[model samples]
Target: AQSVTQLDSQVPVFEEAPVELRCNYSSSVSVYLFWYVQYPNQGLQLLLKYLSGSTLVKGINGFEAEFNKSQTSFHLRKPSVHISDTAEYFCAVHYSGTYKYIFGTGTRLKVLA
Candidate 1:
């Protein structure tokens, strides 16, 4: 079984500030990690993914994450964010060779202008 836990449900920040959204997961077998961003009334866009090799993964919109096996964590980070960054972010895991995915409820990022 695979499960994901997002540490925060909402993160509010002023424009041009850095932010980190924490995520943790547990799985019996190996899995793929993914971060998706969803704007209001829009579908999810792939932010980044950690599959197989490499511990650090970078994604669109100046986002990045480091996969830590020991801690079972994959936290998203941005050096500086803009008001446009406000959206819902989700952490998800997919079992190897399986279509089923486990997703964290979501963490809403509100970047105030």
Candidate 2:
């Protein structure tokens, strides 16, 4: 079984400030990590993914994360956050052959202007 954990339930930041959203996962088999963002009343949008390759991965809107094998973590970060970045972010783990993605509870990012 695969599972994901989002350490923070909510994070508040001022506009143009930097932010980080922590995520961790556990799986018996190899897995793919993904970060998705859900805007208010909107569907989830894929922000980034870690399938294979370099440990450090970059995503849209200046977001980036590093895959730590030893720690089993993939934490998302942005150099500068905007009000538009305010949303519910979810971390997901897709275990190979399972065809299922286990999602975290989600972290709500509130950007104050």
Candidate 3:
């Protein structure tokens, strides 16, 4: 079974600061990487994905991630983050054939005013 690991459980940053949320995965076969965000009590929203072709994938809310196959990592980053960006970020990987999703523990981003 595939799995994802979010290196940071929580991240605290001031408004307008840069942030990076680390994500790593382990899989035996080809996989699809995804980044999703969840606001308080809200459903998860797709942020970005890496199905194929590009290594660097751009996502919503000024977020982006680079899929490094060699490292099995897809770290999310934002050049400048706002208070509204505060949310729980999850890294998920889907098995190409099974279509089953394996999600990371989650990284909580707390933006301070």
Candidate 4:
């Protein structure tokens, strides 16, 4: 079975500082990954994704991730963050023929001032 792991349960970073949320996945076949953010009381929204092509991919709100095939990881990063960025971030993996995503436990990014 395929699985994803978010190493951190909570990542508290000061407002306007840099942050990185780790995501590691394991699969037997080819896989794609995605990063989704869910604000308080809201459903998850797509933050970024890794499908094919370049290792580095960018997304909305100044976020980006690099897919490392050898490491089987796709880690999201932001050079700076705002208080509004505080939310629960999830890492999901989709195998070649799967229709659904396998998500990690998620990491709550707390942007403190």
Candidate 3 per-residue C-alpha lDDT over 54-77 given as tens digits, one digit per residue, 9 for 90 to 100:
899999989999999889899999
- Say which candidate scores most in TM-score: 4
lDDT of 2 by residue, 1-113 (tens): 46789989999999999999999998455879999999989999999999999989999989999999889999999989998999999999998888888999999999999
Q: What is the C-alpha lDDT of each candidate?
A: 0.92, 0.92, 0.92, 0.94
For model 1, residues 4-104, the per-residue Cα lDDT tens digits are 99989999998999999999998446778999999999998999999978899999989999999888899999999998999999999887777888899
**Once superposed on the true structure, which residue ranges of model 1 sit more than 4 Å away at CA?**
none
Residue 40 Cα positional deviation in candidate 3, in Å, after optimal superposition? 0.5
Clashing pairs in 1: none
TM-score of each: 0.94, 0.95, 0.95, 0.96
Higher TM-score: candidate 2 or 4? 4
lDDT of 4 by residue, 1-113 (tens): 67899999999999889999999998447898899999999999999888889999999999999999989999999999999999999999998887888999999999999
Q: Name the 10 consecutive residues with the lowest summed lDDT in model 1.
A: 23-32
Cα RMSD for predicted model 2:
1.0
- lDDT, candidate 2, equals 0.92
